[model samples]
Target chain A: MASKRSNFNRRKSFDAVRAVVNDVRVLVARGLTKSYGDVQALRGADLDVAPGQITALLGRNGAGKTTMISIIAGLLQPDSGSVELGGIDVFSNLDAAAKLTGIAPQETGVYGVLTVRENLEFFANLAGVGRTERASAAAEVADQLGLTELLDRRAGKLSGGEQRRLHTGCALVHRPQLLMLDEPTVGADVATRAQLIESVRSMANEGAAVIYTTHYLNEVEALDADNVIIDAGQVLARGTREELVEEHRLSGLEFTLDAPLDAAEVERLGATNTEGNTYRTTDDRPIGALIADLGSQSEGLLGIESLRPDLETVFLAVTGDRLDEGAS
Target chain B: MDAIRAIVGVQLRIIRRDPWFLVIMFGMPLVIMPLFVDTIGLSLQAEGYGDASGAEQVVPGQVVMFGFMLAGSVGFSVYREHGWNTWDRLRASAAPAPSLLAGFAIPWILIHLLYQVTLLVTGALLVGLRLKGSIIAEFLVLLSYSCCLIAFVLLLTAVFRTINQVNAIVNLGAMVFGGLGGAFVPVDGLPKIAQYLSPFTPSFWAMEGHRAVFLEDGGIADVLPSVGVLLGATVVLAGLAVTRFRVDETKEFFG
Candidate 1:
């Protein structure tokens, strides 16, 4: 157990050092403005995605996350702006940029007539994967995405989760430099979601820049990605989880005791008995000071956790609304 | 080029999975060939064929006419990608519009040629149609006609927004162009107006080449001019298709 913990520390330290070492911007999009008739999709949006990092583009439905990533992927050209992938202009040199990017849109798409393996290889070949290495690459991707068993099955015949996984797998088969996945876990089952998250983490760990968009705050937390909260076609703010949480200025001490406490004891502790077993400090103060004040009473604490702000709270604080709401 | 080749394989696989359209295209022409064989053969006889069976006129005519409609399958395949929500994924590949168009057109051209050839063979077996001229000339006509029709529908696919619109236009165009080009009867039998308009349709050039082979015992030289016109038409239509196709435009399958 000690060895495993140390190994994890080493890996964590390596990630931190690597994050700083490889600071090149994989995607540089600036002043992206797109107007669809009366509805303005994006208005002067700018995004910079660093290599070896997962940047979660958080928003409700109408926040233009899709529009931004679509332009970066070369699926749509911004009406007026510039986007570069790996330093190549995405619009001026689309095919070159396309060679370096992979995107899984909100919708699931695959060739129904082709087998799962065929679908993977087809996209891989399109993205410049050589014919000699495509088969093994497909196998490797299938294994990574939990699709090895269904490789021979027709894509149309797969279950919903399997198909969704394959849809995402096709996008990354060529192992693009930048991967943009738009809510890849929306319809995914528990196992599929976990498998996808693992795949995405592995990709990011290997130094691919990823822009993952989702309305689910939990996905962003699970990814531990840098958060860019966007709304109404603009980026409100961007930071790491701790930075955003701290930036929101949340501070409180919430805990539970092993034994039930009377009102007299709760008042002495100066904590609110929000529920029968839960206790929360009314004032947002440093938990360390509260713990020091408890002194000998600290031994009685069964479980102690700070009321730090989560991603949802940060999103609400930035966007003035929750993340579950659909596009207005 | 690789993107085009890859799409060609995928599109061919998709078409193979849905063979019902091919069956209908194949069946419709076979049924029509026998119904008009006698009357059209008598019509060809009046136009100075010695002992002509209507099989020659009706079989080649139905082949050219229905082959045009079969070309719609290419448009439908392209639109189906949109319906499947795969259009953006394909566009995201950054394949130029012309490559994507070629991918759909090349496979349908091959299939269109096959559709016409299969009908000709079936007509021979079922209606006693016999070859009279150079088989190479007849093959050239089949090749040129397939190329011309495929290019024509590809242009329409690029310009139109929905599969329904393309279908309505292609189905109507097949019948009207076929009639105007003398697929139903000889150009000599049509009114002066249709004969005047006949030369404007690819069907006219196709039927002319087929008749030269079946009626006049023509060699390659006799059919070369018709092939040239068909190829020229193919190039012009392909140019329009390339100009009109937009990679970013969202096409609707049923819209």
Candidate 2:
């Protein structure tokens, strides 16, 4: 726990440097900490999401990603620390902060009995949109999220993906300056995930800062945004995907042999025997040379697989574990 | 104003969609009042009481009961939001707190007024009980009483965590208070302690105010004291609700 606190302090130092360089941050948190009885959910974590940029917050389950978002959204109070959005203190001035932030929480709070249009209208109106404009705004948001056909359908009756789409649309309808989505794409199909990501991208393009939290490394990769990898209630690494991958030394190359090779050749290649005909190798060098060397000697090579360093590898290297473990 | 209207619109929409609310609002009083009048007939005949019409007494009592139910329904509806966790969605919105509270209260007030009118009209047609005072005058009294009741329910909702618990408390409060405050029977028939306690119940003032209108003996000026008590209760309860309510996201309801 002490080590975790120091790591979080280190991440805070990194954010301090970014804050100096970036002046138009849409959301900023400094030394934010929260505890539930003996359970520390967030420990001295710091984060800054710049205007029009998507920041992916990746963590294992119970890594305080949701707690952080909840605090930033003014739904929870941190035990000690400050949070600012659009130059206004979110905790002290909720009315001002409310105008600048919108959140799509992990649990879908969409009213089950209301129709899609009704749900949209309720949120839109709450954002202070006038009645004359609410219907048109609801229609536009529904159409944008591909919820037009489902407008009259009850929200509880929609598929999981459709409900997620509606939840996204509800958050976006207000056009908040900072949007926080907590696991927005969980349980979504491939197509729905792409659709949700596309909507998020469009919102970011419209100059709203986007902070997304997900256990899916593929979402982190798909978002292709600045990354913050949190573990044990503290951010362990913060950088762009390539920068973190480089920092964590996650580059690797692997080759597969079609038939069982002699023990001598496998040992010479520095490959760990995985099982059966499979072998795994992690090397800093380019994989092309290994593939060429294997091709010349073995004609029965059925397939060769190589993985480029990405956020998942960086997360694994930094945390000493896979990103998807224990993620529901 | 916009926030208030928006919230009110949502509440009305919900009330429209809920069949159970509709039955309670419109159908229950219609069924219960006639039965009450008949039961009174049995007792009055057995005891050889005076020749006054039981329907005349029973119908007004049902109107007040309808008003009580209308106001208390807010607790159940708002409690549903707590159950489903949509209350936080509203609180976290950009709307002002007063607007949110007003939006919640307006639908109950309006529906209760509607039910009051239904009881009046149905009572006159089926049971021959005349509305003795001006329609507007009677409505104003009912409206004041309904506002006070709505405020009390809102206060209850802010403190309670579950709709079922709220429902049990609210329905039980309505029944106990309704009986003591003369909604189901005459306050004079109650024990002395209950009679003294009736003044504290908004239903007591409401029943007296309504009875004054039904007897055609007083105008709004004459019932000002009852209206004053009802308004005072509304103010105190509303203030307490606002003070107790917090939109903390860390709390279990929001979390």
What is candidate 2's CAPRI-style docking category based on DockQ?
acceptable
User: At residue B178, what lDDT does model 2 achieve?
Assistant: 85
**After superposition, which runs of candidate 1 have C-alpha atoms over 4 Å from their true positions?**
A1-22, A250-308, A325-328
The superposed Cα distance between candidate 2 and the true structure at residue A78, in angstroms, equals 2.1
lDDT of 1 by residue, A129-175 (tens): 89999999899999999999999999999999999999999999999
lDDT of 1 by residue, B95-176 (tens): 9999889888999999999899999999999999888899999999999999988889888888998899999999999999
For residues A1-328, what per-residue lDDT tens digits would candidate 2 score against the true structure?
9965776677677668667647878787999899999999999999988888889998988889999988898888899889998899987798778867888888677887889999998888888767788899999888888899999999989998999899888887888899989898888888888999888988888888999988877777777788998887798898977568657865555455667778888888777665668765677656666766565655666666665677767886787666783475
RMSD of 1: 7.8
Could you give candidate 2's per-residue lDDT for residues B116-200 as a string of tens digits? 7777788878777666556666777777887788888888777776566666677787787788788877677688999999887
Largest lDDT belongs to which candidate?
1
Q: What is the lDDT of residue B29 in candidate 1?
A: 81
- Candidate 1 lDDT (Cα, whole model)? 0.86
Local accuracy by lDDT, each model: 0.86, 0.77
